[model samples]
Target: MTDPLAGRVLRGDRRAVARAITRVENGDDSTDLLNGIGKSLGRAFILGLTGPPGTGKSTLVDRIIAQYRGRKMKVGVIAVDPTSPITGGALLGDRVRMAQHTLDSGVFIRSMASRGWSGGLSGAVSEAIQILDAAGMEVVMIETVGIGQSDIEIMKIAHAVMVVTMPGLGDDVQVSKAGLMEIGDIYAVNKSDLPGADAMVVNLLSMVRDMKGRSPPVLKVSALKGEGVDRLFDAVEAIRGRFLSPAGEEMRLRSVRGMIVELAKKKLLSEFEGRAFARSVEVARKVADHKMSYEEAAERLVDG
Candidate 1:
């Protein structure tokens, strides 16, 4: 709990912060570093942006970073990219697109390989977010890999989830689907300069009309042209303000609780995979031979 690296990270040293995140990504046991900064966590807001491929999510993130930095806020970005088969690393580093902020020092951007995580986010993203939060980043944004229906897992970790989409490419219908529509706190129709942008916005608005509680707002944004980005920033800030309010305390606490549960589950699953994998073949043979029931084999595995 008294790690020098953690102290440096807490002091907002960008290099130390980067090193901490790298340790997490490389699967090094970072329990001490995390504990060192545990008390300083939960102050930063976690914003998640997810959408299908070709939605220009990277460009939108670039614009959003400028919005936060203009207010003198320290911002952190985690861009989860697809895994590279050859190198087992992030295939498309989004840092390339946000090159303008390379020397800002106030902005820290990291690209992580999804590493075959099924949910479009890197497995180490939560740890990386905690590192950034401890580093005094007022806003930590997570841009997930291009996602589909099952990739809405970002909802569990993010304080606010923005689902970005564009006109054409059947995005209007895609957003209306069950999983995507339910997870979005806000929807941004990117590439509003395109032909079908207005209709896309209308379709989303109509879909969210009967969505029990606060309906997610649909915004028309052209990330490439900087159109409607200011308004988008205003909307994002509004959500941030709400999350920081007294009434939203339970929501924030719930997110923290969920994160803890997820971490515990991951730890248990890692152990189970390591132990149970070796017994799998034998267990399957016993079950196939009717020497042991499936339930019994499962119980045996768990007990071992």
Candidate 2:
């Protein structure tokens, strides 16, 4: 059966695209949608923005959207916000900064909760990207939740990852501590109007100078005042071809391999939660009563 929604998505029907993404988020069976949109996957350029909190990533994204729209291209944004542990919900407020684009059909913005999934991204992000790509979005941007040192999973998925940072955040020392300087393809010092912004840019450039074969650009921008955004946009747009080259093909292959491994892990985790949680209770009781060792209990859980 041909899924009608698939056709609508191909035609860039916003409602249908939104519905498809919702289905993906809910963990529904989306085989038909995936098959229908399979060939349309690589059309959009996927850009990821990640950094610590209070770096003005949301504001920068809003500016980027305007730049893309000025060129008459369709854009999609996936903003991942931290999940609320108490209610298992997200405030989903990244869109508030992007309110200007809310009514523009040329732009599609969706906020996803991290859902306690680590690495600063939810599991549904890749599928959601496909949905927007199939809907004729020429550029799709992923803004990850405020991240720390080990939350570098965006590198595996995005063609280019831009690390956003600003002044007043302890600058180079904090960046080195977080290990963010190495993962970025582009670096933007947002809020460059601030007092310490110039020093931050200089230090970042120095840090990235010995970055092996890559000399990633460290640009300064004030996303709030919209200063230097055009140069930043140009810097980001220029790197799109690097991922589409022969070497990029190799990179894409690795990305696919990683995706497959992640899928298998997720599947195993789902099954484990379903059957193993109940069995673990019995095992725990046995261990507590001194009838079994922790190592033995672990082996039994996996073997069973």
Output the number of the TM-score-best candidate. 1
Span of ten consecutive residues with least summed lDDT in model 2: 83-92
Stretches of candidate 1 off by over 4 Å are: 83-102, 118-123, 146-150, 278-285, 288-296
Pairs that collide in candidate 2 are none
Question: lDDT score, residue 37, model 2?
Answer: 82
**Per-candidate clash tally:** 0, 0
TM-score, cand. 2: 0.85
In terms of lDDT, the best-performing candidate is 1
Task: Give a tens-digit lDDT track for model 2, residues 1-304.
Answer: 5678889999999899899998877778787887798776676878889877768787888789889889998999887767421111122244443453456789888877765665323347777888898999988898874354324664567777889999878777667666687778899999899888888888889889977787989999998788999999988888766666666786566655654555556557767877887889999999999999999998899999
Runs in model 2 lying further than 4 Å from the true structure: 1-3, 83-103, 118-121, 146-151, 245-247, 278-282
